[model samples]
Target: MSNVQDAIVNAKDKLPNVTPTPPGFHPEASVHELKSRLLWGEPGLSIIDVRDHDAYNQCRIRGAMNMPMDRLPGGAEFSLQKDRDIYVYGANSGDTSQAVQMLREAGFRRVAELKGGLEAWREIDGPLEGVDSMDDPGPDAYNVFARLQAFNEEKAKEKRMK
Candidate 1:
């Protein structure tokens, strides 16, 4: 089967029996809500930040444990109970989706991604730490622009060659 078809089958098999959350369920909560939920003790909720260690150390929702996508196989050792809510986030949805897939494959029942990621959090003036200065552009925005530029440049180069 084609990779895309395989991916569709795999994704369908991985989704929990429970109804998935509608898109944009919590339109306002930032990364701060994620932190609060973890800190204030949602008995079964656990937060996983899928960003790399460097970015994680620079700043992340307090108490969020790093579970970078590349390292998620190790998460099986954590023995996460299938019953709990597993909240995953990255600099944005792209990374979050990958992590959610991993968690689902591992049989997590309730998984949710933080909407808009850290950028949305900051936009709404959400709480943050280890961010001594706000001079740095967000990684999510930068990555999107960089990818677009690369694609455009490649297309331009192809046109010139043609």
Candidate 2:
């Protein structure tokens, strides 16, 4: 039929199947919701860390950009489109809400605050960056590859005890 219709059919065939975001979602996103969107391969979204630089550097959601609350106006204007899907977080709920307000006032239409910050992200095992952000630190402080060996040792000790 129409070229636009044909293109839509073709594109739908090529794209991976993904669950769409539900309607009626609030202006705040839970860590689980953001994680689900990321897992579903959603694109054209930005995750912003509105905490201080040191806190961001110490640990933050993987791929999150550090745009401390004070700098949101200029930074968002320079780097983000007004209609971009932006999820921002800060030190706490109040800070996140404040950052969301700043972004909205600066003309960002699709901004949402991430509730519960990094601690909530940690609960869902969301990816993070930093030395302390490892999902599995194993039992050794100095050896990165020691987990398997430790597991084997534990198994052997169990066998001996049995």
lDDT of 1 by residue, 14-40 (tens): 565363211111212344445334323
**Highest TM-score scorer:** 2
Worst 10 contiguous positions by lDDT, candidate 2:
17-26
Candidate 2 stretches with Cα past 4 Å from truth are 1-25, 135-162
Candidate 1 regions exceeding 4 Å error are 1-41, 76-79, 131-162
On lDDT, the candidate that comes out on top is 2
lDDT of 1 at 35: 39
Clashing pairs in 2: none
Model 1 has an lDDT value of 0.58
Candidate 2 residues 1-162, lDDT tens each?
A: 246755764564345335232111236777765665564445778999999999998899988999998897799999999988899999998999988999999888878888888998897667788656765533462453453343334333423534
lDDT of each structure? 0.58, 0.72
